[model samples]
Target: MYPTLRVRVSRIEQLAAGIKSFTLQPCDGGALPAFDSGSHIVVHMDQGRMRNAYSLTSALDDRSRYQISVRLEEASRGGSRFMHEQLRENDELDIGAPANLFGLGDGAGKHVLVAGGIGITPFMTHIQALARQQASFELHYCFRNRDSAAYLDELPSTLAPDQLHLYESDTGGKLDIDALVASQPAGAHIYVCGPQALNDAVVAAARAAGWAAGRVHFEQFRNEVDATGGAFEVALRKSGVTLQVGADEPLLRAIEKAGVKIDCMCREGICGTCETAIIEGEADHRDQYLSDAEKAAQKTMMVCVSRCKGKRLVLDL
Candidate 1:
């Protein structure tokens, strides 16, 4: 597991209709850990019942505090609801150190960013870093309307008029993924963080246009993992214990219930912190962190979201 930081919520502001930004300062009034442009921290809440990743939206050089914006999810599993309703200023919380699953590429002549709804969080810091470096970039932001767009007022003042583009779907504004991909200059890299449908569309368009896989990057804002599966037995080789995982329970929860301590972040499967070695039995791999070839090998599984495909499975533990 990543090392955690004891932080205090110094301030909170409503950024949009359902979005709120939190300013977290070190509990001891010291500097927080430094993070890159596209890094996120896992917030451990509800005595560890919920662990959700929130991107750092503050400037890269600002160590005094970290900012994260959360949207009240309609179908939340208690994470967003707690942040919105229960959490208050001056409250203390534990959060994992910065982890970068989505990073700005090494070298690109130009960069294009596509964001949808709350997916714009990572780009908030990315824009700051890019501007300081005088890098070439363009932002294409899509949202339902102006009122729902988080940071709508700040974005225009932050970026050049020609660099930022907004698409309001409620007013007949639509982003043409294929056209956007086709319009980018050579050696340009595109980064997208948004809904599954938007992600799929951008990836498909890039592939159809013969763009290299390395040039396109994306991070999902939703938990698409269907944790529900048939009941199975997991045997821990080292502990000499076995636990019955319910059809609706995740494997990581079962391990914790059995008093086994495991390191995990981003329970949604985007982070690979919970990956465990497999001694036997195939797994129904559902995580996006592992590649297709890795899933075929069945050597390891992300216990947070992935489950056993067979009746009984053995883990190295």
Candidate 2:
């Protein structure tokens, strides 16, 4: 288990129709751990049964409190719903320390950010920090409409004129990803955070435009993985145990039920914390953390979201 911080909900404000901003302060009234602009913290809800990561939207310099915005997910697995419905101001919760899987390019000549809907949260702090350093950047934010755009009004104030661009689907504003990728100057880095479809499109566009894989950074807000696959068997080499993984159950959950402990943060497979070695068998990799090359190698797999390709897998557990 990751270290947790006891925090009190200082404030909660409706940012949009289904989005709310939460202000969390240290319960002991001390400075919270510092984090980078694009960092996120996992909030443990439902007595730690449900964990969800929310991007930090607050200023990076402020250690007194951390602000995160949660969009009430329509198909929520209880995390977003709990934050919106059950959680209230003055409520106390345990949240993991900040972990950054997304951050600004160290020395890129220009930074291009593409955000879709609630995906604009991380860029909120990114743009602020960039503006403070007088960095060259552009934020292209897209949403269904003004009513659904979280912190739309506040973004313009943070970015300079022409640095912020808006695209509303209701207004027939479509972002031409290929054109956007082609328009970027040399040495520019592209960062995207949005739905899986949007993230895939950006990656395809970048690759087609001859951008190096490292130059294109993307973060998926959520992945709709079908966990109900064919059942398989996992052999724990070190423990000398073999466990049956149910068709409807994830591999990681099965390991835990068998009394095998695995340190995992995001069970969604994006964090790579539950990644374990694969001594034998090919993996039906479903995680976004592993690269195509790594998946093809099949030396290891993220058990949280991946499964064995064959009926049995030998793992160096």
> What global local distance difference test value does model 2 have?
0.87
Worst 10 residues of 2 by lDDT: 219-228
Root-mean-square deviation of each candidate, in angstroms? 2.4, 2.8
Instruction: Give the poorly placed runs of model 2, Cα more than 4 Å off.
Output: 223-235, 239-250, 253-265, 280-284, 291-299, 307-314
Query: Over the stretch 248-298, how does candidate 2's per-residue lDDT look in tens digits?
Result: 777877887788878776667787888899998889999888999999999
Q: What C-alpha lDDT do the candidate models reach, one value each?
A: 0.89, 0.87
Residue 269 Cα positional deviation in candidate 1, in Å, after optimal superposition: 1.6
Point to the candidate with the largest TM-score.
Answer: 1
Residue lDDT tens for model 1, 134-189: 99999999999989899989999999999999999999999999999999999999
Each prediction's number of clashing residue pairs = 0, 0
